[model samples]
Target: MVRIKQRYILFDILSPPSSEHWEAYSESRDSALLHLHQVSSSEISAKYLLQVIRQVLQDHYGDFGAGSAGISLVVKYFSPKTSTGIIRCGRQHLDMIVAVLALINRLGDKEVIMRCIHVSGTIKKCENVSIKRDKEDIIRMQRKRK
Candidate 1:
């Protein structure tokens, strides 16, 4: 029996206008959290992300190459607070998925950038790393408040 291996790619979502948008959050923690939630709410959901990935793959590889790649993009976890998400796909198509991720320049006219920060074979490892990063971010933010 062949064990089907999976890969998880953790990524950060950034918009071109982030600097201007983030400036408003600098004033207060409440406002920051509120703005974070608002931005998170505005992002592309897992379903739409998958569609975009497929479209990108199609555009890059053409119909036959895309189909032959056997890509299946899945969102395992996404957190707006951290502006991070985890994607799951077969090990074989990891390159294809990464390529599509890099190729994505916009999401619904938002002019966004998706940067893959980490890739792992297990979901638990990815979750742990994401948690650690979230904690560090919180610590950094708290320090800046002082």
Candidate 2:
């Protein structure tokens, strides 16, 4: 008997702020506030996101990398309202997937950035972290607006 270990990656995607917003955020020194694009949400769908990731994996790592990394790949959750998602992959290709995710710069016609927030061995932990982070993000964004 063999235990097939898996890793759950919690990630978020953001669309670059419109050019007007970028000019404004860039001038402010509060780099602490990374709103360079405080995009409230986006139009990304799970199907689109999964497709982008898979394609990028193939492009950057080639067929072999894509085949191995995608063998167990699954997009577990995606919320367009939250612009967040979770993906599960085999432990062996954790770094490969992360790298491929980072390489994804655009999805559909929108320029988007995919960021890995939390990685854990269990889906529960990833979900918990994402919820907590979402709350914090809302609070932070509200404060920035005030």
Off by over 4 Å in 2: 27-43, 142-146
Model 1, position 39: C-alpha lDDT score: 55
Model 1: lDDT to the true structure = 0.76
Local distance difference test, candidate 2: 0.82
Identify the leading candidate in terms of lDDT. 2
- Model 2, poorest ten-residue lDDT window? 31-40
Candidate 2 lDDT tens digits, 33-127: 46533443455777777787899899888999989898899999988766788999999999999998899887767777889989999999999
Clashes per candidate, residues 3 or more apart or on different chains: 0, 0
TM-scores, in order shown?
0.79, 0.84
Model 1 over residues 50-132: C-alpha lDDT tens digits? Answer: 77878888999899757855455688777665567899988888988888889999778667678887899988888888889
Q: What Cα-based lDDT does every candidate model obtain? A: 0.76, 0.82
RMSD of 1: 4.1
